[model samples]
Every structure is written in C-alpha cells, then in structure tokens.
Target: MRTSNYDKFPFVPVAKAEACQTGWAAIGAALRAALPAHATPGQPLVLAVECYPGTALGPLRQALTEALHPALCLVADDLYRAPADLDALVAGPLTDDPVFGRLNGLTVRDFLDPQKMQVAQATLAAATGQLVLVLGTGATLVCPSPTVLVYADLARWEIQLRQRRGDIANLGSDNFAEKASLKYKRAYFVDWRAADRLKKQTLPRADFLLDTNDPAAPKLIAGADLRAALAATVRRPFRVVPFFDPGPWGGQWMREHLDLPDGPPNYAWGFDCVLEENSLLLGFGAARVEIPSLDLVFAHPRELLGEAVHGRFGTEFPIRFDFLDTVGGGNLSLQVHPLTEYAFDKFGLSYTQDESYYMLDAAPGATVYLGLKEGAKLPAMLADLQRAQDDPAAPFLAAEYINEFPAHRHDHFLIPAGTIHCSGAGGMVLEISATPYIFTFKLWDWARLGLDGQPRPIHLAHGAANIQPDRTTAWVQQHLVNQVQEVARGEGWREERTGLHEREFIETRRHWFTGPVPHDTLGGVQVLNLVQGAEAVVESPTGAFEPYVVHYAETFIVPAAVGAYTIRPHGPAVGTECATMKAYVRT
Candidate 1:
C-alpha cells in the first residue's frame, strides 16, 4: 500500500492498516454510505457531532445511539452559555490592554446563545429520521443543516491531558492561571482564530469528515479519501507527536529526556517542531491516529507547506522545533518577537518570530541573554523594564542593558526578529525559528513566578514595541554569533553553514558525519536534529525504503516527497562521527 505520487493533489487515499481494522464499525460504515436512501425511518437524520471540551459526550451519546439504531441523542451541553453566562465569561474583565489581551477567550460566539441558537435550530428542524446531534463548543456554530458534520477534533495536547486528569471539566479554571489564561484566551483570542473562520465557512459546506482524533479509531473521512489524505499529508515523512509545557523556566531536561507522562512541574516546552502545537501520529492497524499538526497544515497547504511555503506562510507552518529547558531550571523570558510588518500589523501573524538558539546542552556558566550593550539605552531599557514590572522588588534589571552570552555545547544563538533573547540558567534550548511561536514579547522575567504562582505576563508594551535598538554589542557579535560556513564536502561528510539568519527563513546545516550523508529534499521541508548523534539511518536510494531511525535530541522530518536521502550513522564503534542539524526552507 505504498503508492502515493499525490494524484495531482486532491486527497483521500488513507484507509490502509488492513483497511483500518474496523473501529466504530468504520464510523458506522461511513454513516451508512453517506446516507440519503429515501431518508429512511421518518425523514430527518441530522447527526452534527462537532466536539472538544472533554468530549465523552456521554460515551459519544451512547455510541451514536447504539450505532444508529433508531436514534435521537441531542444534548449540545443542554444548550450551553447559560451557567450564569458561563460565569460571567469566566470571571470577566481581562484587560491589561494589548487590545484587551487580544480580545481574550470564551467564544464560538460566546458559546451558543440566541437562545442556544433557537434550541439548536429547533432540534435539527424537528427531527424524525434519527437525529443524533451532540455538539459542544459553539455547537457547530449554531447547528441544523447537518446530515453529517462530525468534526470532533481534540488536541491542546489532548485537552491539556484531559485537563490534568480531572477528565476534562469544561476547559477553564484547572489552575495554572485558570488554565493558562484560558489557554491564552482560546489560542490567541478565541478558539483557533475562530476555527479558522469556522473552517472557511464550514468545510466547503460539510457533508461527512469526522476524525474524532483517535477516540479509539473514529475516522470517517469521506470523498476521495478525504482528498487523498489531504494530498498525501503534505508529501509524507511525518512526525508531530511531541507535547510538553510547564514553565517559569522549567527544567530537568524534559524530565531526563522524554519518555514523558509523569505529572509536570518541570518540562518547559517541547512542542518539538511546533506545527501549530503538534500532534500527528496516524498508524491505524494496531491502532494509532491522533491528528492536529494543524491537520496537515489545514489540509494540505499546497501539499503540506510547499507552493513556496504555501505562498509565503498562508497555512503558516514556517519552521519551529522548540524545547527550551533550562535544565535543572530557571532563566528564559526577557524576550521580543514581533516585526515582519509587526507580526502582520500587530499579531495577526503571517510570519515573524525569527528565533534560533540551537545549543542543545550547556551548564556551568551557561548564560545567553543576548544583544544590547555597547551604548545600550532604549529609554534606559524601558525604564529598567518598567522598574522591574512595577517593583516586584525592582533590583534585577540593571545588568547594564543585557548582552550576556557564554552558553556552550554547540552554541548557536541568532534570534533575528527584534533580537533581545533569553536562555541563561543551565540550558538546552534547540528553538529553531519562525513559526510565530507564541509571539514571545516577554521583556524580562527573573522576577519570576509563573507555574501559576502568578506574577508572569510581562510583554512590556509588547517588548517596547519590539526591541532591537540596533541589536547592540557589535550587533550581537557580528550578526548573532556562530556564523559558520563550509557548505559541501563529502567522503565521510562535512556540511556546516550553521544558522546565518539575515532575518531567518530557516536555513542552518551542521552535518559533520563520518560515513554517509547524501541528502536531498531540495524542493523544501527538512527539519532534522540529532545534535551530535548516537544513531542515524534516514535512507531512500534504492534500499527499497523503510529506514528512518534518528535519536539523540531527535527531531525528524524530510517530506518534499523525500527525493534523495541517506544519513547513516549509528556508533558504538564503527567509524563513529555523527552530528546533524539540517533545518530547511531557506531556498
């Protein structure tokens, strides 16, 4: 089942894993072959579904009313929005300005009102032919016209791991600043840009799509295999799966390098290759599934980011990687980000966070603040970061307009957009840029708190309207440090060109190796990582296929239809050498 040259792009080829080993009887036989046989049983079979918010929805409404047996279901959270107007919009008034903190959260048009959208459109227009509704967040923006809609996605890292195992309680107030400020007010102000404008106005007038991101295999993707699995999931070689957060400079290097699942407290950021907050997975047979890596960049952004990065960041998955971990813990905020027409005229981001970091490990005297010193002054570093965020014991800021440096293991830095950076304490970094990773803006944090003990949110006037002040200290030691060169070598490999960043578009190179290298994906998408290896692999040149491997600091990804590959390392002896780094897109 390996054929996939993107059938000139349209999508829908997914079903392998021995025809997706039956799950919910393949979404009840894909809702009985996309319904409509003289609309049986009475006439109205609505079936909306839509979900997210601890969705068990009473065992998905008793498994779609016992797999569609004379159905009825209903319950859009008993027509929500009322629990005293969702507790006055979750205890209201959140305005530290940035346009009321990007118009803060709670939506789906404030969770379905208009008398719960006229009692869910008069219970899907006075149902008769098995109407199994059951929606939740903004009940599919006021339900009704749905002979099959089903969305049911779930991933904000599995709804913050089932809201930290309380098994999800209506996404809010599970502490951590009432669930990370209502998950940064519903992903930067109201549910994923209002579900990408209600999925470009309801997925081209929906009919049947249901993925339910692996509720034990709830797939259903219709028509031309959901457009050839969204144009061969953006050209293949996938990864996503990473997710870890905790902060205030959290550490213990991903709690001793990832095997995850132990209550947080440390793990600061690891959305490794943050494709809109990671997910992917999809195996099928022995059951796998997952989804959201912005669902293959909102269903094939020109086949998973290619048409010149989907015509310059439209479906926006312009590189990202992640992992900050101040090992054992502390330092990171003091940020900046914005720029690029000020993150698309202030936060409507179409591209901006130019990041870099790299490093990978570093401890004794780790340092790394960066850029700003030789005659630094941006209004005395914005009056010493507004007198240390209004006197939380002011002392911290005067380290003479920042600059620092030192960090070791591989050391890379770069940062670009507005320069001023962070890292410090021990280290680990990685970062890799420009996917607008939470538009940083920070502006100092050593006066610490966050991990919900409070005092965090700084964005000092959006980092003084995006800092840079000519990125001082000899413009960050001649352009953000480690500007290596070399490029191509061969015979036991060489590579080089480590992160140049003239305002990054993601370049980097690194390599080093000892035996194999070859590489290609020149059309685009690359990402790699193994920052000094223990293993490698990759493959493609006729060795029929199946290779991949990777490891040590692991990151992965190649896709641009893989083209030519081969990395091959794995050591314990045999000519040991390895290194890796890669990144891509710059061309």
Candidate 2:
C-alpha cells in the first residue's frame, strides 16, 4: 500500500488578518473592547450571537454569559414559535416522506414569533447599564440592530456528526431522540435552507465570524478577513476539508488508503468537493477557522463560478466530486435520480442529480449495475422489488433485470437522470456529477437493513415514475460505458473526452501525462481529482498563484478567475504516469 498523503484538514492561508482570537476568553475580550463605543446612556449594549442551525448553544451561551456578565441574556429558542406551531409551519416543506421533501420558501423570520420578538425587544429596551446578549439560531431576528453582530458558523458535516451523536436537535424542535436520517431530511429541506438564507443576509453585516465547529475550542476572525480569505481562495486552486462516513455497504479502502483513524465499521462515503456539506478552513497564523464552504459560493458567486454558470445556477456550485467505496464490502442500493420535470413538480428542485461513476480502483470481478437489461420491463422489476421489500426472505434478483458491466480502474460509466444505476461491491468509485445529490430514489437495497437496524427507505413509486425503459443494455453499451475519445495529445500527455452523456450538462475530461499538462477553466469552475499516480503539483503559467500540490484521490477546485494552470507529476510520481479526471458545467 502507498503511504497516505491525503490531507484531511486542508486550509487556505489568509494574506492579511488583524487578529484571530481563540477561545471564549479572547473572543469575549475582543467583543468587550468593541462594546464601549456602541453603549448608550440608558439602554444596555445588545450583542447578537447569531448561529447556524447546529451550533452548540450550551457552551456558547455559558461561555459568553460568564465572560460578558450580561445584565440579561435571551436565547432565541425562547422567542421562537412553539414546537407544535413550528412543526406545522415546516410540515408542508418537510413532507411525511422519510428521505425526500419539497424545498420551501421559508426564511428564519418565519420561525420566530413576532409577539415574543417584541417582548424580547421591549426587555432589551428597558435594560440598564450592562451588556445584554441575544443568542441562538434566530437571534438576529429578535435583535436586528445590535451593538455587535457575531455570526457563529458551523459546517454542515459537523452538524451531521452532532445529529448522529444526539448532541443537538433540529431548529426549534426537541426531537433529539429521533433518528438522524429523519433529522437530516428536515434540515436539508427546512432548517438549513432557512438558516442559510439568514446567514447570507447577516454575514455581510457581521462584525465577527465565529468558528463554532468545536465545542471546547472556538476560533474567531474579523468578518472582513473571512470574506477576504474567500475572495483570495477563488484566485487559486484549493480543497475543502473532506469528511468520511461509514454505511451498511462501506469498505476498507479509505481506512487503509486515506490513513483514516480506526473507527466506524468502514468508510462508505468521502465527501471531497460537495461544497454544500463541506467546510473550508482558513489559516490565521497558527490558528484555523472553519466555515461552511457554501459561504464562498454565496459571497462571491460570479468570481468563483464565472458569469455564465452563476447566471445559470444562481449562487449554487453546480458540480460535485465524491467517493463511493465498496471495496471488500457490499453493493450500493439500486437507485435512480428524477428527471428535471419530475424533480421540479414533485420535490421543488430546479435540477436533478446526473452523475457518472469513474472507477478509481476496482478489484477483479468488480461490477457496476447501469441502466437495464435488454427486454427488461419496468412493471416486472417493480413487482420484484416490491415483493423483496415486503418479504426479506425473497430477495430481488437484480442481475436478471439490471445490466452489470465489468468495472476496471479508470472505467467511466455515465448515468444521466432516470438511468437506474448503482456501484457494485469491490470498487472505489469517484462519483462526478451535478450538485443536487440527495434526490436519489432508492428502488432496492438488496433486502438489507440500514446501519440503524431499520429497513432502508425505498421510493419505488418515485423510481417507477422516472426510470427510462429505453436505457437498456444496447443503448448503455453504445453511449455510457467507457466512452472515451482522444481530444488532444502533446509530447508526453494525452487528453480524452469522457462521456457524461448528451443529456447531461456536465462535461468530463481525462488527461494522462508524465509531463506538465496545461488547463484553463474556460470561464467556469472546474473540479478535478488525481485518479492516478501518487501526487502532482498545480502551478500558474504567469505566477499568479503559488504552486498547489495534490495527492492521489484528492479532489480540488480551480475557480473561473484562476484562468490558466498546469499540472505535472511531483514528489514520488515525478517520472511515473499520472492521470486526472476533471468535470465542469458545460457552457
């Protein structure tokens, strides 16, 4: 096995920073220093500690109250609508479905009770000569104009971990004992959407950006410094912090290859470039501040995504690169993504997940289930799936109806929306696709239970509505499997166009080289993974940015503003062949 060079906590260095305070003592002192100016003659100084949905409020409230010795501290949870009322308010968006829900147009203000907000405001108004801190998820809604606004940020991945640990609950809900998957579904469809909307509105005006991912250790940076760091990052190639998780079908590849710690049964998913659920770290001297990677997309969409992509998808990062490792494990659930019209009509999604499985490493006899077998009927397959789900003793004979293709290293299988597909066991797949990743409708799960010991949720009705009967063996063989064509070649490198199918908006390119290969973003963002060799260094043609080194299986992003860069073998892979698979939105 190769020595692991995978950087788990990659951080971008901030060029200029006034200060990065660590822990509550330093942060509170800094806030206290800034408080004298905002203090009034009669009313108390109102400090709003606005938080993302999953921030640890106990430590935050305790630490701040101890440090500031506030005359009165109000938690936003106290001002929110009652639990039943809040549930009813979000029930429309968070449907009864266990996994899928409709995207709603609710904002953080909708969760706050106006009468309670007025009461809090009146209390703050009647306060005397001391600090009055307002804290919690919707703290800003209660005190819009505060003496100091500190936006406490937490990454979505950390939030998921907390959810699984039962350390935190969903926004305005006391269902900590509920299943993590159900909590995640609610957060995805309701909590996060509302929190993110508030975050976008409050970040620009925030005086301090708090890194609250860690309960014991908190890092604080000036809001301007955080914004500047994000702006600077767009001009250079960088990576978000990758997080891994185990599943029922997880494998040992990541634990062995990525130098992961000994925990969890196995590593099933590696989120390398899913900005919505990843965190971006910024370096301030010896300290690191963690914030949601989506902050960058929201803060500088045009600069990071270019005019065309930003205009087409708004502030969303349209592409994602992640890993599905099933080596020495079991098969993934048979699934299909919804068609665009079906996605919009049913789930309120503007787009669907059109993805491809690029084999990073495949053991002998590894296979990928793609599309359908010739003469396979949807009704028959659905019936079989329903029967298997109904009675676990009778397994669904998947091979009879699904096309299983032999998978090898570097094999690219395109799966457009409505194409039923899954990665079989014994392969490490680099899944490159559109960013609407959670819209998958699982048709079958091999009649196995989830890690939670419950039957995994199936969407047969949703899947039956979207699966394309025409994507049979013949069509898939001609269009999807390993569709590589030589696009260009240089002295020691060659470029190939890999298929994402004509129906998909994302285009993929593969380059194999023992020498430097030039690349440009073509006025849009690009996501690339080093699929071969040990390591490579990405450099600028005009010294616009410093050289960035990436290890094998590491996915990095080059923003549209970067313009041009070159990748060449570095370190142990100097003379060895190296290959990179890059994906970008087709313009």
Candidate 3:
C-alpha cells in the first residue's frame, strides 16, 4: 500500500522484490525478467497486459494490474522473487482486477506475451507439437526482408473517437496508441511475396487473419487474446504470426508505406479492423492480400451485410461487426436520408439515413444534435444552412450544423435518411448503422480533424440535396421521442420505424437483461457489439465464452442468418441502462 509521486500506475506501489523503482524503463526491466526465456531461436516467452487505473500508479492501478506480478516471479534472476510466488501465479494471480479477474491460473510467460509474440512465435514454430502465444504492440518487429504489409483501417474509430474532447493529451501518436491498443489491435503474418521486402526492415500491417468463418471467432475475448486462442484452436503448425500493434509503428508505417495514388490513401468508408490474428478487413479494399482465400469474400453478401442491408439489398456481403469509439464529438449534418428514390436520384449514393448511436458513457449534460428541433420551420432551416456560410466558419461545415439534442447515457438516436443531426462534444459514442455508404450532407462544423492534424472535409453539395423539403422539424419530436418508452422485457427485442425507410431500419432495445437473447442474421448478421459493457458475450456455435461471459466495452458482430443466440450481459449487468434502437434486420 506504499504510495508515491507516480499516481498513474504501479498502483499498488509495493516495493520491488528488491527496492523501490521509477520510470517505465525500470518497469520494463522488472517486467522483462518475469517472462520466460527465448524458445530455441525465434520463440520468446509470451505475456498479456491487463489494464489498470491510477494514471500515476498507486492503489487503483495496483488493484487493476494483472498477471505481471507473477511473471515477475518467473524473472527471479532480476526480480528477486520467491519461486513459490511464481507457482502461485501459474495457479492464479492475473485475476486481481475486477474486469480481468478470471484469468489467474495462466502462466507468467502467458501474462505479457501470448501467441504471435516473437518469443512465443519462435517457440511455437519449434515445438512442432505445441502452440505458443505472443502479444505485443507494433514496435516489437525488427525485420530484414522484402515483405508486403497490409494496413486496413476498419471500425468507425475516427467517427466515434471524435467525442473524446481534449482528453487526447498526446494528439495522434499518443491518442492513437491508447485507443488503438484498447480496441484497434494488430496481427502479424508472413507473406512469401511480402517476406523478401520485409526481411531486414519490419513494416507495419493490419491484423486480418481472424476468420469470421472460424467457429471460434466470436469466442475470442479481445484482440489481445486473439493469438492465444487462435494458436490453441489451430491444429497445424502456423508459421504465420499475427501481431498486435499497440504503438505507432503500424500507423506510421501504414501512412508511409501504403500504395497511394497521388497522396496517402484516404481512409474513406468505415469498417472494423484488428491488428491481431491473420487478417484485418471484414471485406476487401486497398489493402494487400496473401492469396485467393480472402478474394472469395466479395461474392458472398450474407457474410458482410448486416441488419441494414437485408432490409434493402436482398442479400448480405461477407462482413464482420464494426465497433467505434467516438472520443471526439461533432454535430452531424441536418439532412434527410432520401428514400431509395432520393438515393438514386439526388446524389446516386446507395443507402441513406439508417444510423444508430449506442452511447457507452459520457459527461453529464453533453448533448447531440439529432433530427430537427421539435416543430421547427423547414424554410427557416434551409435558409439558415444557406446563410450558415455567411459566418466566418461558413466553409466550416459539420459543426453545429444539425439540430442539437441534449444526449445522456443510454440515449439512442436513430438517424433515418432525411434527419438532420450532429454528434456534439463531451461523449464517447458507439455508432452503428447501415454499411456507412450514405452520409449525404455536411453543412457546418467548426472544422476539425483527427489528432493527425487535418481539417475534416465537408460535402455541402451532397448534404444539401438530402434535406427533407417539408421540414416540420416535428417528425422526430412527434414520432421518435414519443416512441420512447420503458423497454418491455420478454420481448427479446423491440421494433419501430425510425425514419423514411418504412422498415428499412429497426434498432434493438433492451429493458436491461430480461432473459437470453436471440441470435440470427437476415440482412447480414446480428452484431452484438459492445456499446458499454465489457465482457459482453453472445452464445453462437463458432464463438463461445465462459459461463456468465464478461461483456467488456467492445462491439462484436453476430453474423446474420445464424440460429437464435443467447446474449448475456456482464459488468454490473446494465445496473443503469442500455442503448436503444430498432434493429433493422431483413424479414
């Protein structure tokens, strides 16, 4: 319980097996010794890091630190720890933290580095019979060859992270590492064509190997644990190592190495991407691929399409669930998602409207601009946008452009095509919706960009054409807000028309853990994405979880068309509330 200046971490502040220490380097040293030795030539001891509180390290952090203490035992040469203590960890010690308290019996080496870890990788590659797991950030690689690195930016990270406010002290580098480490994971793999290029210089790439088809895909706890599970599941020896990038190595390299036409590749559409495992994209795009295996993803729509598509497209595309953390916030443009006619007529964009906001957490009183204010004038609204450019920030679109709504926790706002809105600051929102192809307008914005230092672009032409003509501003106020009611338990789900698409969109509503949930995919798949809870679990044949599985704050895609799924909630079991929306799945 000893305390000190570093209140951020080492929360316990316990004297080292030796003496008091300072600095991350010293911490790293203590950590290094705790791990097992390198296996043969390429394999190294693996470890998994559990998160904790106490920014400066103290009681809170120590309370949260996982398995590291036991690993320190394994490094007795450096830690001066008792051998028995190490044994204690092998039995159970990683579960000190409430969120990750279940994994106490894992070994020390298994604490920090897991499968794909350089150490674990080298070791597993050697055993011929056993599998090794390694976990790491992007910086661990020191390559010396010519290899192809595929960097895919999936998940609506930029969109959700936009709500972080000034909490992003480190800008792009620091912020990216934190959020990226938390949700955006990495996976390392060896590509023969890519091997030569990366022989000497290790390049960054996306983790795209986790097969949605793998029965164990949904069972994976998080991106960090993905390797250990994959290794344990696979029977054959896999030379391919999927690495997780917890640092700037992959992001920086991805920006620099990508084969952009003129400028760097612009991360256009939103999709989910993990830096662990063997693959990154749920679909395919500008990223590089190893062989014909991933090529077949396109022909299959049921694999990619979600609740949104089946309701319209008559099919699904091979796709995984998309999770987002809107750290920063902005007013979504005030506009209507045109019916299929407006989509094909106005701008030729495919699906419009159809957006869901699953708010995980937020500061008190922070509001989001949802559809037009109750009973407002459409003529005046259009007049305002036309005149919005009159202000100095005129060109600054996407700002307080849409109708502003005060948003609090569990507040679900459905953005049907034609609804004018914007996500204001002061919240971390989980944005889920149709296949992200229908953002039709951008009228105002104070003009902002990601930590990378760039101003967000606006599409006034596209946005303007989508505004509902007879805007009474009362559509949502009258129908949407009024529809809000106590979640009826036993329904297993809820339904309602959000906007113009009749039944095009239906957000899911939970009365907070009434019973087991149904799992199936009509449009694509029912995505049980984690909007708030950590350790959220869905019982599907391919993916499995511990009894009373934990629903850590991470969104997961429950592939559409599957049989009924039993959804279980963890983490205080929604003691407070749950995100609201009618899940728009195909009938």
Clashing pairs in 2: none
lDDT of 1 by residue, 1-587 (tens): 23211111111234566534246766776676566642446657666666655556666666666777645556666765565565457444334443223434345566555775686677666766554555655456655466667666666676656555545454332333335355454444555655555554555445545556456657655434444555655554545667667777888766665556558778888777777777665553454555566766766666555667667767767887878888788888777777888777654555677878888888888888888888877987798788878887775564688888898988898888887878888998888887756667777788868765877667788778888698888868887888888868879888889775767778888888778888887666778777775667777787634665656776877766566788878644237887888787875
* TM-score, prediction 3: 0.45
Deviation (Å) of 328 in candidate 3 = 6.6
Sorted by TM-score (best first), the order is: 2, 3, 1
Q: Candidate 2 lDDT (Cα, whole model)? A: 0.92
Better of 1 and 3 by lDDT: 1
Give each model's whole-structure lDDT: 0.67, 0.92, 0.34
Best by TM-score: 2
Error of 3 at 14 (Å): 41
Better TM-score candidate (1, 2): 2
TM-score of each: 0.39, 0.98, 0.45
Best by lDDT: 2
